[model samples]
Target chain A: MNDKLVTVLADVFGLRREQIVPQLTKDDVGNWDSLKQMDLVVSLEREFGVELEIADIITMTSVEKINRILKAKGVDLEA
Target chain B: MKLDGAVSLITGGSKGLGLAIAHRLRAEGARVIVADIDNVALEALPDVFDRRSLDVTQPDEAKSTVEAIAAMYGRIDVLVNNAGVIYSEPLVNLMNPDGMMHSYDRFRQCLRVNLDSVFIMTSAVVEQMVLRRTKGVVINISSISARGNEGQTAYSAAKAAVNAMTVTWSKELGRLGIRCNAVAPGFVDTPSTRAALNETIIKHIEGLTPLRRLGRAEEIAQAVVAAIANDFLNGTILDVNGGVTI
Candidate 1:
């Protein structure tokens, strides 16, 4: 599950899997604008088979926040 | 998406081309809501359509109306941005020497109706679609004038901008399962068209078109239906002109 999340983040941000750390954030990525954020939302939703609410989407500004939100939504990210 | 039982909204749909599109969508089994600023026209509409008064140029009005529709219908499956005026004015009027150039006030007015309204309404509707996780469709009514028409400076510019926005939104929203496309009609036989052009100019345009006739409003509506039905059709400016190019 962690590898899958990293793969989605890497694909959406156009970075390598090794670079997709939990500390990574919108400010850390040059291309992470509003549009890219939406792309990330779609990617995460598809990769995790989850429907994200607008509030969850807004708060998902970093990898750590995304992991927390997924866990709260009942996605078993720990696996 | 499937049209049956889908909630559809058509702005400026109380009459003319918009009304035609609304009728077609209803025939396809969609729940049709016709919104226009014309109260008289709204009242005159048949009992089949849900009527609402709307000024698409107002952002707050647009947002509230969209929210109301979503609350009532559960979700908005389709949005047809068919509200616009057919304005024509030359960049430079050789006959009117006193004020040879087109008025800036009129230019802004045209943009407000044709361009800004699209932005406002689409933003509101897409917000609902995104929030509800609805796979919605946005159909913008463009014009062949978008390719640039003579003596239609403001109209042409506004439509060109509409086309640009259509493409931009399609790219931005595709992943969310929302589709954006436009129907660019040629000279259609409608009250607005007749009001905008005299018989002589209309005749001249018909001669230029390969079909030697102005397009019917129903035919333009057919194009709108096609745009909605075809799921793969995205970011397209479907020109329903009778082989006329400008």
Candidate 2:
């Protein structure tokens, strides 16, 4: 799951895998704005094969938050 | 992307253009839902089509209705924002003796129904599409009047805005695999138009148009279905006006 999340972040934000950290918030990332947030949402949904609520999308600012939200949506992070 | 077994919601589908679109889409194998504020017309739809009573202008109702449909069908594959009203009063009626000025209420009501409702309903459905990663199509029913029409200031403005937003949404949502397009029909021969428009006015419009006659609702509906079927036809307001705007 972490590897997939890193790939999605790297692909969607055009960031290096090393740049993606669990604590990396939108504020820390230069390219991660609201519009990019939506891209992230789409990428995450497609990658994880899980639907995400708009509320969850809005709150998903960091990798940690995304991990929790994906788990909440029944996506097995350990898989 | 195929219409077969896809779920579609068309607002204002109780009669006229909306009903025609509902029929056309259903015939193409879509599971159709016709939503309108008129309960009577809703009740009269055939058993093949699902019917829902809704006032699309209310945000809460829009949210709840979209949620209900998503719950039932698992996704909304198509959304036709067709609910709207037109008021043909001039910006100022100087001939009035009672001194009833062009009221704000009239203009606001037109915008509320025509413009605001589209935004509200589209947002609700697009959110669900975003969540489910559904490649949805949004068809906004626009009119030739969007370019300009005499004494139809409010209606014209609202439809023009719809066209603008259709383009905007197409750009914004295209990357998500969702496409937004519009069908701007010319004056159509419907029961309401036949009753409300006089012979002289109708004749003048017909003469002005290249086709020399008003369009049919079925023709407009066919254009809508075609728009949805075409994968690359996004951000375009397909003017189904038969060269009238020319």
Residue range B1-246, candidate 1, lDDT tens digits = 778898999999999999999999999999999999999999999999999999999999999999999999999999999999999888765334467678999999999999999999999999999999999999999999999987899999999999999999999999999999999999999999999986756876898999999999999999999999899999999999999998
TM-score of 1: 0.75
TM-score of chain A of 1: 0.94
Candidate-wise lDDT, in order: 0.92, 0.87
DockQ of each: 0.01, 0.01
What is the lDDT for A20 in model 2? 85
Best by TM-score: 1
What is model 1's DockQ versus the real complex?
Answer: 0.01
Model 1 docking category = incorrect
Worst 10 residues of 2 chain B by lDDT: B92-101
Chain B alone: TM-score in each candidate? 0.99, 0.97
TM-score of each: 0.75, 0.74
